[model samples]
Target: MELNQLISVNFNLRKPKSSTPTPLYMVVYYVDDKGMKVQAKIPTGKKVHPSLWDSKRQQPIMINKGIDLTTNQLSEQAEVTAYITNCRILVYSEKNLNFDEIKEKINLKENNEMSPVTQQFISAKKTPKATKAMEVVLNSINESNKSENTKYAYRKNYNKWCEWLRDTKQVDSMKALSQLKFNEFKKWLVASGATNAMVNDTCGYIVRIIKEIVNGEGAIYGVKEVTFKKLATTSTNVKCELLEEEIEALKDTKTISEREEFYKNVFLLQLATGQRISDTYTIIKGEYDVLKDDNGNEFIIIKNKKSTRGAKVKKSYIPMTKEVSDLLQVLQGNELIPTNDKTLTEYVNIEIKEIARRAGLNRITPNGNPLYSEISSHYARHTVTTQLSRKGLTSEQIALQLGNSKEMVERVYKHETDSDIIAKLQPAAANTPAPQVQAPAQPAVAKDKDLEYYNNLSDDDKLLYTKKLNDYNVLKDDFFKSLERQPERKRKAAAEAKTREIVQVWGFEGANDMEYKKLCFFLDLIKQDINDLILTYKVYNDEAPQGGMISAINDYERLLINIGKLTYYCHL
Candidate 1:
């Protein structure tokens, strides 16, 4: 009988009592290729029975006597069933049966009939060694002497590797494990579309597992040694910077949105004070002081929260310009902005990049990523230093204001000296030198005819030409005089006006009451004289009543120019 026939067979057996006559009811059937068939019935439940060949006498014979039952009683019974059941019975012919054919048939039948979960259980039972090894590795990872997070990462990587090995490589027995085999597995990992970082991490986990198997309590489990070729580090192409126009454009955006307001204030504060995002978010109200120095020059003091030990500890004391003061006033009421350093930095960087993209300032690198250039929130400090340098502040002076070393200012900032800055800041030389008039030189001794010709010209024509020349000369004189007075009187006048404004705002009662009061009075008097000059120039230029008017206008203009120069000096 074939295995397929045996799959559907059902049978029963019985043995007779000692004294009772056995009832003959059992039946057997067999078939042959020659169309021959046979059937037989023997006394049922009889251990031993005889063939009924003779009528007068009955002969007794063992049930297995005629059959070729070479093996044990169980084998004989199994063979009888195999013969009667019409199924393939390879187990009866185990020696002559093809092992591969039998295995294939068995596997096919099992696959067709078994549930998925049952199949998994059979597979697990078959690979008990590999399963036990995996458990040991997992246990070692759980009891690792590393940080909690590190252990967690290791376990995650290990589980992933184990799953891959089981699913793809069909890795089970200890003898199948090898470094060469693992190298192939690594290639598969790359082909499996894992990222470079992921591949590295997975390989790292495998290596750690091998190490643990070798050195950890799981050393008894056979684990092969692994050597991996290190993967290259991927570059992080991150760009963060604001453009000049973008920074300028931020000033015009005035939405009441909290994010917008936060960004604006943060940006303005950074630009004004040159503070980092980290330090800017933590600035308290009381940390700033708008006060005068010993020389009575007004300055803004900012105590840095991020200062470390062994560094220059001086607070950033910038001069309180109108722009800076206005920004501070706007931010005065809020306790803190709605962001921390990391978020603000990231937000500003993203917005700056977006702004650059919108403004057509987005620069692309050779590799097609955004190029790193232009201004950022952090660049505000450099901008301030550069602007101050442009305003003719010395490196030392800037360093003092920024609370940095002069060497740092010169090296990192590349700050120019006051003289160098002045050279750049000065206006290009004006054309034609204020329209000078050339006086006619005396003519060489002329013949009598030449002299007679000179006398023949009309007096009206000569008078008109002379007046034009004189007027040109007068204008030229006044222009030079204005230039000469610019460094002194005009600047002084402006300074005095600003001083008086400050005093009035502060409501000082009298000039002699305090040093500040005296300074205010002096400044006011100087401002009054400068104002009078300006007024006189306005009056003279408006109505040219007489020749004296030109002289007065020129004088007042000179005084005004002087006051402007004096103001610059006073600020310094």
Candidate 2:
């Protein structure tokens, strides 16, 4: 249907059963595919009676009889025009348009325009009215260029909060996101099946959005409508990691499907590397992923994908163990787990839990509980972190091992046990050097006596001896480096030999006096040409008259070539 030629819209007053104001109803008329005239009715959701409705214009008359644009009543009439325009757009659309899509378009446009920041500068007389925190959040989503995953997380968490709020009928708008009510919301989220971490993350996103509104640095929210304090919802530690034996069992257990096996290998690699599922599952064994140290040892280097805007991305090189190297070899020239992260997580979790069951490593606690209550993709990380912690690795070291921040290791990875200080106090290894029987050289000490004395020294004395060892090593390196160079006498001899070869090649031994005189004349001319060329360039540019320095240089080169021929002729 040609919308411009055939389509038209008309508005009719909706008659209420009683004598009361009712919204205008829209009717769209166009020819159908079968060449029959058709009409569709859609509600404008704007209240107007028979007297106010303009049937010919098919638009509602100004809702306000007054001539003021600033009046709230005029705003309502503007909204009616907005609705009518939305219907006209739908009627003119080339594609078959649905009511839902039209409604969504209107809502999206309204939400975009409904920002407090946009309204703030419009009217300075009145303080900006606070909207819902959700509105601010939705606006941020529309404006944000964050990664899809981060945006999804923000929207998902906000939706969950919205669901809870709608049930309680609290915090339905930005004006209600006050600190006191927020505390109630936070408590409600926690009580309503949200784990502490979930509640913290969900509430934290809300708090951050609220703070952005108050700061007015980016998108502004309405002026503070209600006083509120920040929520204290820091993420709590989650203590579910695999033990050594459990990890071993997971390795030993086998799967039946290639897909399951793919996830299993992915899990093993993640466990070994402590990489996130995003990095681990889609690993490609290419040259860029492999790093070789100065000593030529190879490592797999990975940079995490979870970095904040303007933050330095976390990256680490994990030394390739035999198992990891073998795994890479198997996955060589192929993507090990070529699938989405969501599917990879499901396969890994399912196969890993089954593997644990088969190995009878499900639980081994004093209370007869399993090592992990639920095995998920993150278990690989938690397992690696906890095991490294048990091996006496520091938070910084663990963070590097897992490609994460030290604060993360301190908070989430560490499962430290009580230690006895006495156990750490042990005798240092004997520093006594092996005896050397040769006579003492100059600047040397008695080897046997010195070694014996060093062995009996205290910690401070031992530190001094260690420094001496370091100095000796440095001296040894310098001595070895010196071996690559020649002495001054040999260098001078080599220079003289080079000069002899040059003179012999010039035919000085065979040239007659006349030929030598001719060569000297050419050399003098070439030298003079060089002098003139340099003077010409220094005094003036090539554009100056008689300033052909480049041509003079070319002539000098031709003379030098002739001199070389003369030397060869003299040899003949």
Off by over 4 Å in 2: 1-237, 282-288, 332-336, 364-369, 419-572
Residue 257 of model 2 has an lDDT of 53
lDDT of 1 by residue, 362-464 (tens): 3554234433223356766666676666555678988777767788777776434566545765565521133437766422121223234323437774454
Off by over 4 Å in 1: 1-246, 253-256, 282-286, 293-297, 335-343, 363-375, 415-572
- In terms of TM-score, the best-performing candidate is 2
- Model 2 worst lDDT run, 10 consecutive residues: 441-450
Error of 2 at 460 (Å): 40
Per-model clash counts, in order, read: 24, 5
Candidate 2 local Cα displacement, residue 31, angstroms: 83
TM-score of 1: 0.31
Q: TM-score of each candidate?
A: 0.31, 0.32
